[model samples]
Structures are given as C-alpha cells and as structure tokens.
Target chain A: MQPTSFENMFKDAFENFEAEVNPQIWVQVQQQIPTTAVTPQASVTFSGVKTLLIAGVTAIAAITAAVVYKSEPKLNTLVESKDNPVDNKVEKTVAPVQSIEKVLPELIKENETQKVQPAPAPASTTVLKLPETTNESSANNDNQASEPLNTVTNQTKIKESEPVVEVINQDDKHENNLSSIQNTEAEKTKETEEIKDFNWGRISNTFTPNADGKNDVFKIHLPDANYFKATILNINGKILHEWEGENGFWDGKDAGGYDLPKGMYVYYIIATDTNGNTHKTKGSISILK
Target chain B: MDEQQLVTNCLKGDKTAQKQFYEMFARKMMGVCLRYSNDLATAEDYLQESFIKVFGKLSQYQFKGSLEGWVKRIVVNVVLDELRKNRILFDSNAEVTDVLQTTDDVVSNMEAKQLLQIIQRLPTGYRTVFNLYAIEGYQHNEIANMLQISESTSKSQYQKAKIQIQKTLKAQTII
Candidate 1:
C-alpha cells in the first residue's frame, strides 16, 4: 500500500537525512565498546590505573589539606600572604610535602626544609572536616589555596617512576615504614621545577552555587594575565558558557542564565601571559548545592 | 570494502575497519536516533549506546537482512528502552487539541531541522507512536507489540500526534 502524503513527506525528509552528531559521542562509544576495535583488557587495565591514580591524588590532597589546617597559624600566614609573591612558593611546597609524607614519608624526608612537624598527624575526622572549612570561603579564595595542592600531588605522582603503583600497595602502612625507601634528591629538584612552571590559573574541582556568597561562582585564579579566555562545556561537549579576561567567572548557570543541574562540567582555559607565552589547561568542575 | 569483509574485520578486532564501519553508518543511524529522541544530547546518547550494542551483537547477526536495517532497529529499540524507563508515556493523561487543517505543501517547505523540532515538541506517547508508525513504517499492531500498548492506542496516539504537528505548523503560519 502507498503511504499517505503526510507520512511520505516525513519519510522523504528523514529517511536518508543525516543530523549532525557530536564528535564526543564517538569518544564515549569507543570507551564503552570493550570487545571490538579497542582491546577490552587494555582499556580495562588503563581505566583501573586511572581510577587508582585519581584516588591516590585525592587522598594525598586531603591529608595535606588536613595537616595544613592543623598547622593553622603558619599556613594562615601562608594563605594570607598568597597575595604576596614571597610566601606563595613556600605555601605551595609545604602543603604538598605534608600530604605526600602521609603517602610517601621517604619522599618528604628529601625536602625536610619545607616539612611541617609530623607529630600532630590529623585523625580521619580532621581529614573529613578540612574540605568543609575551606569550602566556606569564596570560590576564588579556597580553591586558590587548595587547588594547587592537588596539582602538586599529581605532578609529584608523574615525576616518581611508577611509585604510585607501589604507593597504592603500601597505603595502609605506617608513615615510619614509608620512610625506609629513599628517593633521590635529583627527583625532588625536578618536582620543584614542574611546580614552578604551573603558575597559570587553577580551578576548584567542586563549588556550591546556592548563593551563600562563599564559592557561589567558579572562578579561575589567575594572578597576572594580559589575556584569558575560557569555555565551559556540558558532558555532551556542547558549549554552555564562555568568558574572557582575568576576572571572568561562571556562576553555575548557562549562557542563558538558566541554572544548570549539579553535575561535572568541563572547562578549557587559554591564558596568554604578559611575556606572550600561552598557557592551556582543561579540567572538570562539579556543581554542588 | 564489502559488508561481509567489513564485518569479518570488525569481528577480528580491526580498529581501522571498525572505525570505517562506524563512520559509514553513524550519520544514518544518528538520523534514526534523532527522530526517536527529544534533543540532540539524548539522541547522541541513544546513538552511542546503540552502536555499542550493534558492535557487541554483530556476531549474532546472520546477514539475513540489510545491515542498515539491522542497525536501525537496534537504535530504535534503545530509544524505546530509555523512554520506557521514564514510564511517563503511557501513564500521563493524553491532552486533547483541535485537529487543525494541515497541508503537505507546508510540511514539505519546512527545513528538516524545523520538522525535527516540531516532532521533538510532541508529547512522549504521541511522539513514540508517531515515529514508529509514520516514520519507521511500523504497523499499529506491530507498534503495540513493541511498545506493549494496545493497537487502538497506537492508532489514536498517531492521530493525536498528527493533529498536534498540524496545530504547531498552523501556529507558525507555515500552512
């Protein structure tokens, strides 16, 4: 039987019609298809390692933040002096060492100059409370202080030769036993170099946008920049928001000023330093109530 | 390459052949997925999910029909499965609207995107049935079995969907 004119019109339009599909769909599909094209075993192992690395980085960051929170007065000076150039490096180095020592005591011993007294190790309860206190500040305030610590942790992980693999294994071990394995002084210098190069903007992983004035907006903490441009994208890789200049921020809303649901969003930033060097960084941000 | 060779290479875990196979059908399948979904994001989700299923179940395909037809069915089923999870299609009360006069010339003049937008604005029940019966060429009884709805309901949903589309087209002064 012949189709009606109405049915024929739609079929004619859509039968051979091709709609534009997002390229990100192919990426997600590739990640999921285990048995075909990509080796299932290899993808599984790689993702497993990635998850472990993220967990290890997060644990180190938490421990470091907790320790820094414990040594409140000294770090308080460091946090306040974040406005000054003199104390920025000290604050960055000390925070990371405390956290790294919790996971790798031997590594911290190499940088004993920046080490805080490890006697008052923070309890698990203290570790859980640290993020809350930090979250109380504005997005630029707390993230400016805490975000680099995670970057340092990640950079340190990359510098060590597969030690993250061993770190995971020795996670439950006491700190004293971790100090047995000595890391070369050369590696410490390399880590310092990596940290020095990452002076560009850093963003927080999560922010609360319930309009409490504290962290109501996701801000990129760029100390000095002639040019800055950032684009925020939803999971589908669609651009939701875009901003330029150093003071630009996203208040958990789309370009239309609609509140986006709380979920992980991706941000791509390109900042041109006063020296004409460009810095590019991309990471995920999560919106919370 | 021919279909048999491509399928064989894909089954043997050839990355190039798998990508070629995907590039070959991704557009057409995305069209099918878009018609069944409300937005590009949801359509993309169904498209990716269905392709994953297609690749996984490629071994089960007996080369009994056209590979495109086989893949399209999988894409449609994935969308229906997702809509079923919402469970709003059958449970929501059907709203009544006047059946406005529609001209085939008006719909034909509309760009494919405009037509797609009109289809997307349809209520879930009417949209699903309209896609299955009008676009996918499924009979009402077959759609009833697929959606687990009464055949009469499928017919009425399609009719209501047609009226809704015509109403929207009329409102746009396209007719």
Candidate 2:
C-alpha cells in the first residue's frame, strides 16, 4: 500500500524538470528551419500535377486573350529587332503588320543630336512620331508583354533618331508595372504551394476520449486541411460521428456526446486544401473508454 | 540578448541569433518534452519537432505573453501531436483499488529518477492526463478542451492515472 499517490510523485519529479537533451535534436530542428528556406511557403503549397495543370491552362487562356486584344507597336519593334526570329512567325500570325508599316518612322533620324534641344522644330516632329508609336503599342500591349524586353532597347536605339522613344520608354514603365503585378501573383501561388505535405505523416489513428489527456482527440494534421469532413463508422458500417473542416479533432463520442462502445471503428476523411485539391484517407481506430 | 531583439533578429534571417534564441529555450522546453515521452529518444524527437514548429510559427507569436510560456505551449502541443501519431494509449481496464499502507508518511522517499522511471512506465493515457493536470496544473475541463474530451473523462483518466502511478510506486515500496 502507498500513502502518496503517483500524481504527487510525478508532479514533484517533473514540475521543474531540466534534463539534458541530446544535442543532435537541435541539428535536426535546424534542418527544418534553415534560414534561407524561410522566404514563403506558397511555392510548395499545391502538390501533384493537377493543380499545376489547372493553373497552366488558365494562364494559357489569359495569354490567348492578351494576344488578340493588346496593341501592335511591340510587334513593330519585334519586326525591327533582328534578334528575335520567334516574333517573325508571331508577326505573320497576328498580321497587324499593316498598322506597323503605317506607324513606321519615315525619315527617323539616325541621331538628332540625341536630345530635343528644346527647339520646337524637333519637338513638333517628335510629337507627330510619338502618337503613332503609342497607337501601335496600345493595340498589341498583350503580345508586347511576352516579347523580349530587348525589343524595347532596340526601339530606343532605332527611334533615338526621333525624341519620341522617351515617350515609349514611359509606356514600357507601365508594362513593367503590369508584369510586376503578375510576378506577385505567381509568388502568391508559390506561397500556397509550400503547404506541401507535412514531414509528419500518420498524425492520427486511435483516440480514447476518456480524456486522460492522452489520445483523447485524434487530429488529422494537414497544414491546410480545411473545408474537409471526417466520418466515423462502427464495424457494421453505420456512421456514428462526423466533423466538418480540417480542424478534425474527434472525441470518442457521436454528435450527441454519448460514449461510443469500446471497439474498432473506421474513420473516413475527405479534405480540401486551400488550392482546392481534395485528399482522402481512411483507417480504423480502437477506442478505449 | 533581449527576447524581442532575439526574435527580431531571427525573423531577419540571422542564423546566429536563431541559435542563441534556440539555446535559450531548448533546455527548458526539452524538460517539458521529457515528461510527455516514454524515453529519451522519443523526448528528443518531441523536442526537435517542437523547436521546428516554434521557428516556423514564431511570426504569429504576438509577444504579449511570457516567451517561455509561449515556447512551452508549442512543446506541449507537439508532444500531444506525437502521441496522436503513435496512438500509444494503453488503456487500464482493471477494477482494482490501492492497498494503502503507512498512513503517517504522506510522501514517497524516492529519488527523482525513480519517480521519472515510474512515470515513464505509465500507459500513454494515464501519463498524459497526470502530466497535464498534476504536473502542468491544467484544470480537468481545460484538459478536456485541449484533448477534445469531456470534463468527466479527463477527471476519470486523471484518477486512473493516479491509481496506476500509486500502484507502481507502492509495488516498488518507494512510499
């Protein structure tokens, strides 16, 4: 017989515990939190090819619409730059070549002192040339987006003969802004991708909700395991309990809070992550109440 | 060396600051991990995973509470998570009572290591409730919320765990 119960023994033993932990544990932890890999989790959020395929198909449709609706000045620059042969076939396909010819700089100066010289004579000519370039760029703005930026540089060099290239560079700035918005969206997707599968699998199995604080709650632990539902069934295949969402912590009770009979029960989980990928896991758990 | 400064530096990608911050809490957190685990190896795993999570979610910590308390909470959660993964519950179905002896001595004259050993030998369910309620000073209802069980269940598990631990200590004649 014991005068003191185990609770007193344990509390006294553990209340201020300061045991020597193995140094190797720190090494393992450091590997998971490498300072450099800490940028954003979105890159790894969506796993498998299905999410990528969907994102890709959507991006393709967007590009096609951009090709049809955007302006033609970028394509004119493409026609001018000897560097991109890819745009030649694109030039034929879009066939906005007629506008390109109309907007083409006739008597474009080889180098008109490389500056406006603040003289109205050059300014008037530049004003005349600038509008044509603006019209074509607005027409093919979408295609201009995918075209190598080198074309812009080539335009600056080609049309430096006129003072209007400075105006086009301003347009290029807006395009740069447009592309930056696209980059941030891609970054957001990358962050979601970091919801990659967790290193800890099998985060749940049996739960004895008798609450000794041990196995009282079985949790299905996907990082973003949200918008999901879990169902528990007896051996006879009768559904006993169901929980909605990825916050799947199940106590050993049905929805009514009655103690489930002690036995093996099957659990079925269907979860959808933030990326809309659905995951399913099923298994049996033994409940001891 | 300041807590806020260390946290800020770690957030800024300073590896040295992270190591310093880790060393500050790792020992104490490891102690909490040990009580929830059956062995030093499992305790080490609990410690490792806990720190990794702490680092991962450090941004969410608002610094409104005690830093140690924040870290300790993460350690406790990780231990529970590991227990769930392993499903190491050993349910006690015995319908037995304690054979009380030596009523004058209300305490056990056992070494701390002996106490830990007996605790280590407890079934997962018992040890967990005992650790939470007895050692960690959580109310049974709070434990219920943490573990997703009813208050009655928490109370019962804690009581059973006490009985089991007392039985082990008595069998060893430490009380």
Q: Tell the DockQ for candidate 2.
A: 0.26
For every model in order, the fraction of real contacts preserved is 0.68, 0.55
iRMSD per model? 8.3, 8.4
Model 2 TM: 0.48
- TM of each candidate vs. truth: 0.46, 0.48
Candidate 1 chain A TM-score vs. reference chain A: 0.32
- The best candidate by lDDT is 1
Q: Write the per-residue lDDT of candidate 2 for residues B11-78, one digit (tens) a residue.
A: 87788888898999888787787778655546766787789889989878898888888999889998
lDDT, candidate 2, A1-289, per-residue tens: 2223444555575556677867777776676663533545533321212243346643333323233223223334334323344344333433432332333333122111212122233223333344464434323433444454445443533443233333344444644554565565444322233334412256555667876877787676656664666777676544567677555567878645788877898886656556543455568988877
> Taking the tens digit of each residue's C-alpha lDDT, what string does model 1 give over A62-141?
34433433434333323332444425444444553443566766544544433333424323333343343332332334
